[model samples]
Target: MSSLVFDRALYRRRLGRALAAGYPDFLLARCAGDLEERLSAVLRRFGLAADLGSALPLAAPALRGKAEAVLRLAENPDAGGGSAADLIGDLEALPFAAASLDLAASLLSLHAVNDLPGALVQIRRSLRPDGLFIGCLLAGQSLTELRQVLLSAEVEATGGASPRVAPFADLRDLGSLLQRAGFALPVVDSESVTVRYGDLFALLRDLRAMGWANALLERSRKPLRRSVLLRAAELYAERFSDPDGRLRATFEIVWLSGWAPHESQQKPLRPGSAKARLADALGVPEIGTGEKPGGEKTGGEGER
Candidate 1:
């Protein structure tokens, strides 16, 4: 509904280079591995599986031998080359027919989607009944120290700051979105990864190599002032560094799972329809109506 925060085109271009380079994507690779491990635990067969927009080259590798066939969808066609993905497509608009896919996953992706809800709905539509979707993305808490230091430095230098860090989806919003997207039994959880860097500049280099540099549409057009950058680095070391002068950076990864609605799936009973009472179920003494649990009548003003 609001204006786009992330510049998808810029993101794609950066991601393309990251994919071509031999530089290792430690965070994305780790997340992909963890996602695949969880998918394997499901022990379900997937006739048609898709890895939705994962930047890591290992996305399809993780799904190998688990799915009958896997396709890696990438926003940039160049990023998909030499990979196991048979087709390259946009993350916001999946190029698949309804009820075609049995499983889908997006590792360290979807955080940059301008229309996440729409993308999720498309993923649900592409899956058949009882289809499973597992995904992991960077949450709001990721890069807390860097964000803070950058903001503080900029504000102090120019008396103002521009949008530098993109907003992230939290667990609650993600779970609600899955339900809104027609997913059943939706679940959301998160894990924190703390990486220590020798300095803030080293961390920035890693982020650039991972294609995680700021791509906010509303970002400042002008380059960041050198003074601000130096001050930010100073503040970072002062506030977030640990002993031995290594700076701590937090990356919060949120994992979500949902299944396409099916008739055979478990459903909750309607309100006031349950046959058992809470007191009886817990083996507690049953209090009569209008009376307290201690056998005292709760009538009159005392009830108020």
Candidate 2:
């Protein structure tokens, strides 16, 4: 079986179409706002930073005074900007020499990557020593209400369901992925944003405009039955409607930051090398290595 999750080519085409039509930038704007705040907190400036495959042209504006140059990279010529990207490339294979970039920032990208682990490793490798990487992706129950209603409606109508939504990574898993990718000082955190819409169709329209429609490899080729769609809308209204009759949709944005390993960065102390015991710090009784929590030694049960 193919391990693929997203149809990258199809997604690029859809993204292009959305961009040409002017994708609603509310979400992208929100991400960019957060990015600005995070970037502002950092003390140093960057020589060159790449916006790797963000759906919108944001990095240059966000890094106006921080970075000397911003390289906008995308899968196609007209992606991530008006006329063309500074560099065209795919996340599966980044086009950068090892330890080349001073910083790498991607906004609202990376969720659709098939080989996320490999891509992360490549990002880490492309960064110069102590280079910073900061990005955000959709994760942890994003669009869960839409997912549930659609699946339930389909199963009810056709007696079988299809993959209509992409699976999101858990926060813990992404944190571990940074460590696995050899990123130092890794930080992973999530935020939830809820948007209200008049109805399911309104939400769907927004999603379509955002190029977030179903592009799953296992997605059903046939269009969703009108009956199923209507039923789903009904279910959504019934289950997720607010007091004012608007439907609610949740978007979970996960922000991740890490640095390329360097000698100046902080390191964890080895086990048994702590200068002070945790118990001492906490003013609690210390337990010996072989003793039980209750201060009982091994073989006590046998004696009893």
Candidate 3:
């Protein structure tokens, strides 16, 4: 697997801060906490505490029979003694046996991964039959207004197009990816959250703290000009500000759920149960007949 184009260390630090902010009503917030708190929540939600520690090799039991496990492929030299399995490696190339895990999860991750499909495939491979995988990703519609302003301002100030932000998969495309990755009974949905900021800079700050910076393949060599930035800020405020005079930043959260294949759930469709042909139901003449509804035999030239 290729290394992510974005700065991974910087991203992790930003994500840590964002998670620590504890934004209410956000799905990511629910899973952000110390290992014990996070594990307890997961256990309570799934209602599977018994034998959870044993079932998960790298897990530790916490309050209410909750457990936490951190599996990494490579060992971190800096990491101290802990139960957390330091399997530090790429998610796209997991070092685990096939069908070993019951559940897999990623929180505010995978967006920066270069090979998203490959990473998903690896996750699927690690799960047992009927296993579950849940994750969140930043989609195409997120930060739409900011992107437009940046592009327009860059072109106007620089007299050329600078590197644009990375392309994100739309909802439709994400759904197709789930199916293509061999997840059965796949379901995909999205939620657009509007975060209001006093100004454009505040929004950018939050975005940076959330580990979401422009990771264009071809980044600009020169520093951004103050004039260009000011113009961009003005454009952003004028175009995307709400009635309250606060700039609105949209973050589209995509929720994906799917189950692995199971024989007990498989069933063939009933024969001859499908809908009738459209031509037959509408009483329309068949194309090869070359005749009108009035029963006139049109010539070959007329048919053309």
Candidate 4:
């Protein structure tokens, strides 16, 4: 097995800082609340309840109410005691029993999980037949411009590449994993969001506050030099800043939704359908039995 890439302890610390800095409150007031409203509208279009808040009164109740029961596996226990309940555990190994849940939802959490596939499989195992699973994760394409600028600056200053940033899943690979984990009707899509920053340091600060810090599998042994940091900032501004001089951080958010198999699901094509011979269809020769062209073996008697 590959080594875990995400440090949960570090992630929790960063998340705590973000929460303390009122990031969550801002998200709820500015964006998450609107998103929840939009989700509720969509659900209502499908004849589901619009009063999702009453059912699951979390920050984003629409997303929460979609799940029969929600569990958030964090390294630390949740302090908020409102609508959405939380659990302190590991995603790779959920505490629920098999077929115990109807739906599972995760938001901006799986990107930091090391065993992403394992966690998906674990979640699948906890779901009942025809259960739904939905989540959003960061993709590898995120922050491409920033990475390029940082790399160029690092080489100019330190005569080598700097340490790697965090690893994010590609959308295609994530879809394949859903199928590999026995999910049916998997769908994966991505959207990009651009955040403007005054400077590179501000961008890094936002990332840190969002609990998205570097957790490279192989880190540099030596400490970063002051020159490298200075050069990196300058390069970042020159390369990544817009005409207005605002730095931009791009994030590609991949959404995945899939369903657990059920007895009522339609069956896929069978292997035998591809093996049927044209001659057999034309009534010229036996098919799939190794018979001769004229219906008799020219070489020897049948082994049977």
Residues 39-134 of candidate 3: C-alpha lDDT, one tens digit per residue: 444433332211111111222233223323334332222212233434545554576678876666555456666677787777777777877666
Clashing pairs in 4: none
TM-score of the candidate numbered 2?
Answer: 0.92
TM-score of each: 0.92, 0.92, 0.69, 0.74
Q: What is the alpha-carbon lDDT of model 4 when measured against the actual structure?
A: 0.64
Q: What Cα-based lDDT does every candidate model obtain? A: 0.86, 0.90, 0.60, 0.64
What are the clash counts of all predictions, listed in order? 0, 0, 6, 0
Q: Which residue segments of model 3 deviate by more than 4 Å?
A: 1-27, 30-86, 266-304
**What would you estimate as the lDDT of candidate 2?**
0.90
> In candidate 4, what are the lDDT values of residues 263-286, reduced to their tens digit?
886778787777777777897644
Instruction: Report each candidate's C-alpha RMSD, comma-separated, in the order given.
Output: 2.7, 2.9, 7.8, 8.5
Evaluated with lDDT, which candidate comes out highest?
2
lDDT of model 3 at residue 203? Answer: 78
Per-residue alpha-carbon lDDT of model 1 for 208-238, expressed as tens digits? Answer: 8777888999889999999999999999999
Q: Model 2: per-residue lDDT, tens digit, 247-297?
A: 999999999999999999999989879788789899999998778899878
